[model samples]
Target: MPDGYSTLHPAMHGMVNIGVRAARRAGEIMVRHLNRLESLEVIEKGRNEFVSAVDRLAEEAVIEVIRDHYPEHAILGEESGASGDHEYQWIIDPLDGTTNYLHGFPVYAVSIAVAQAGTLKHGVVYDPLRQEIFTASRGQGAQLDGRRIRVSKQISLRGALLATGFPYRITASRTDTYLDMLRAVLIETAGVRRLGSAALDLCYVAAGRVDGFWELGLQKWDIAAGTLIIREAGGRISDFNGTDAFIESGDLVAGTPKVYAALSKLLAPYARGL
Candidate 1:
């Protein structure tokens, strides 16, 4: 399996062989592009929609490493839409926070996920600035730089610090969905933060830095990789409506079991139904 697809869930042999190699390769390229000395060309796809040359270069680097090994694996990325022809796909955010990167905010990351038959099996979220790497494989639990990590054990929203992300495309059609959630979390939780980077937001949830996270109008690239990391870290994830429609609808909430329940209740008022 040149693309690492044949390794599937990793047989103890391929775990270190393929997954680690791909992740380290992606991280290397990420560092190369994010050196901050390169001439970054920021382009806006919409009002706040941003893409940069670094994004494309980063994606190309990841694509090459993944494709060279698994030419059959499909790839769904932010800068480059979708490609390849395989049942298993690699979802990626070459640069998870282009805005933050452009502004030198030191909060961007590279998120990578592998899914088979639409089920996420493995994920990697790397923060180049911190050189921190988070990884997860189905039933294997989550790990940060090879050490196991788990979500916080917080039991209630009142005691939990939560994270969230709002779509830059928040038009009139989606305004209330954003504002209502913000207000609900603000009133019910200890604190609320809009980190702008969905990947890091979910990573924080998995790492226990934040007890919970939710967002509306996200894409696969934004949450796919981080979602697996959360689940494998002993966290729970669901749509705003408490369904497994996070990927399909791009509406999601994730946290430790207790925090998720509390936050879900707080968000109930604004959700579709009672």
Candidate 2:
């Protein structure tokens, strides 16, 4: 256990432990197969949506750990789908950046989050390539490899680095709308990055590597863990309308308080069907 675990409440600590265990297990599987991508099987889940044998194996690795420790907890996984029916649900994205991973880009991650009664309680995002583990409990704050982390204090969008992702469903009706918003942000910010991993993008916000992040068409498994980590790291998150509906809306903007407010203002028009 790390020194930060000594400060977390018992239950929260246990959840974090289990989550870290699961993420590490899955991450190990990913790392082991990282060099053998050419031999792996791949499938297209939807237009531009992909899955691979590595994703299935990693997801099974994660589910196995969670099931062994908390058999009754429901699981909502990207590869395996949902299992069990309990108030406690574990959301798992065994491999968050599949496209990048398939291309050997070294930017994917294993994301895990435990939510009780629909409220996130504990979360973890582990980068197998970088060997970075980001964890957070609802009120226990966020940590990066045992050290406390916080969002950047950048107060303005100008000169602030931002991160974002383009929805995989580029042929959808809203692609133009999304592109417009991206253009606006790119013109106003110091730089904008498209990392292909929503989980890592949010973790970057928490680690202060990026001042803010926004994205669309993300699933619960994509943002659940990272959202809790950001909030606990002294950042704010919400839908384009500035409501607590981002999780359900699949559209989110997050950053330090001031940066969040600026993003909200810039994105509000697009959110309103403009």
TM-score computed on alpha carbons, candidate 2:
0.94
True-vs-predicted CA distance for residue 219, candidate 1, Å:
0.5
Q: TM-score for model 1?
A: 0.89
lDDT of each: 0.79, 0.89
lDDT (Cα, tens digit) per residue for candidate 2, span 128-175? 878788999888999998789999989999999999999776445678
RMSD per model, one decimal = 4.1, 2.5
Q: How far off is residue 259 in model 2, in Å?
A: 0.5
User: How many clashes (backbone atoms < 3 Å, residues ≥3 apart in a chain or on different chains) does model 1 have?
Assistant: 4
**Residue pairs of candidate 1 with colliding backbone atoms:** 2-69, 2-70, 3-69, 3-70
Off by over 4 Å in 2: 1-12
The numbered model that scores best in lDDT is 2
